[model samples]
Target: MRSWNIAGTLDVVPAAERPDLLAEPVAKALRELGADTEAGVVEIDPEVADTEQFCETYGSPLDASANCVVVAGKRGGEVRYAAAMVLATTRADVNNVIRRRLDVRKASFAPMADAVAQTAMAYGGITPIGLPDDWPVLLDTAVAEAPEVVIGSGTRNGKLLVTGELLASLPAAEVIDGLAKPII
Candidate 1:
């Protein structure tokens, strides 16, 4: 297995902006789901370069990892929340499928910059464990059955790897369909 975490700290941007590495929400969610797992957060080089790199560097199972995405719907120029969990192998199609589900005129990918600021997570590293509770959370039916999965740790340089059973424990998560279909 590839060694996880470089030294002792994760590579946080702005250096000073790094927060204390703790197991608050991630652990809580796991416990709620009956998952007895342990997680460690350490600063490392940016883990958001690409999916391949994310899997390789983190020693993550490429086929089983999950990416928690925050989707939004707009009505009268106002944005509402809709969350989706998709397999790392697939992408979330927000335009055709998710918009109608959210019951909004339009749905779009919230800018990474804005999402980071709002969630206090860097772009490409947002997880669903402790997300804002107001939004409707959806877990792709595909991922709900996996044995284990890795998710974002609210930062780009770290990830919170947990069991799929643990993720299903979240009250807000609703299993849905059409996570993604890779184009050949």
Candidate 2:
């Protein structure tokens, strides 16, 4: 097992070993992926779960953190949803790339209530690990190439440490060249 520590601040343990630290769905997904999944989990203060605060408080590199956002679009009166993963230093291109990929007239971040309700995850901790099967998991190339990244654990009280390759292997995941744009 590799050391999953982040700047010597977070004590990351194998996610399979700390099932209690993950949301039920996340835990279940890890289990289903079998024992070789390269992922870890660490408990955290819910107050610092958001990307900026969590990175600052935990001494985690901002570039080594990933954010998962739920996006929604409507076409022909039907709603389509997807999860977009990008490094914390960038923002997902929901209006153009995502809109075109989703094949919707327009795409936007899903409302907090709708996102949480649909994913059964906490508002600030919607990881792509256990998203609905039909929802595409869009992975930014940068995120997929990162050696390691800190991401939400489906609950505000914890975070997951995983390799980009692990995320790229998730169900329905699609790696894209420019899924996000650097924040200016």
Candidate 3:
């Protein structure tokens, strides 16, 4: 059994993987903030490619995690960008919410390669802490109530479990709503 200790929390991760400080901003920031964290490693497992599958693999309630993402778009053929942290139970309303937030005519998901290269974080594991401060980070209101929510650890092999309050305190996070909607 492998174990990872961050701040003071215990977590289970994949065995035989090296820890990279550059990859996990939440863990690094927590250490800087003096929070105790602990994590563990086990056999390696594949990561979910989509949000629905991610919730299944983690056995986490849809509302228990906040998905941080970077969306890319263009208006008048010029590129635009927006960052958002939304609840697993909701989807960002790019037209009404995120579009206006970024002040762009059109918004859409960034290409996988672009998101990975530009953000410097794994697509499945993007977290808000290490993100460039200038980008707007919209926090779904649901996340504020969760005691511990799973966020991308900036890596593919792990996830960061942290308190909602901690996320609220990030450098430039703004709490908002309508990140997700009931799938029907």
Candidate 4:
């Protein structure tokens, strides 16, 4: 396993043993992508997996945490799906950028059940690394350029730490400016 210096705080473990990532498909994809070494996984209490609590408990910088949200839109009887990555300090432009980019009349966050069924991962732990090939992984420029960021680990029991450049290079990822707007 490659060594990760996560601001000298997070104790990253192997992705295989991540408690919340018991799904075979999600774990296989992570291995195939070499995410174990490239993007290290850190096991944590599932209770603190949510961004706010995770950062606060782990002493991680809030700006270094990114959120991946799944969005869905339907047009002409067909539904399109996408996953958007943005820093915790900002919000995905779901109402504007995402809806326009998906070329749908409207766009909204994918339902919890649908997102879980599609990603085969926990609802709050859907990272962009191993998403479906058909779904676009929208990355905000700020997220793509950050030195390092903490994201989901395909399970609520862990988190994935990776450089923005690495995350931006995933398959089907499209990095765009203004993909997210600052949160008030």
- The ten-residue window of minimal lDDT in model 3 covers 1-10
Candidate numbers, best lDDT first, in rank order: 2, 4, 3, 1
Q: If both were scored by TM-score, which would come out higher, candidate 2 or candidate 3?
A: 2
- Candidate 1, which segments miss by more than 4 Å at Cα? 1-19, 22-44, 47-50
Question: Residue-wise lDDT of candidate 3 within 7-116, one digit each (tens)?
Answer: 13334543124355226554555566554243222212335635567666645565666788787767777777767877776777767778877777777877889878
Candidate 2 residue lDDT tens string, 1-184: 6776453398877888877778888888888887324688889989988988988898989999999999999999999999999999999999999999999999999999999999988999999998889999999999999888898889999899988998999979999999999999
lDDT value, residue 172 of candidate 4: 86
Candidate 1, residues 105-160, lDDT tens digits: the string is: 78888877767666665567777776767767777777777765666666665555
Error of 3 at 93 (Å): 1.0
Task: Provide the lDDT at 105 for model 1.
Answer: 79
Predicted model with the maximum TM-score: 2
**What RMSD does model 4 have?**
2.0
Query: Candidate 2: where are CA atoms >4 Å away?
Result: 5-8, 35-37
The C-alpha lDDT values of all candidates are 0.62, 0.89, 0.63, 0.84
Which of the two, 1 or 2, has more TM-score? 2
Specify the poorest-scoring 10-residue window by lDDT in model 4: 17-26
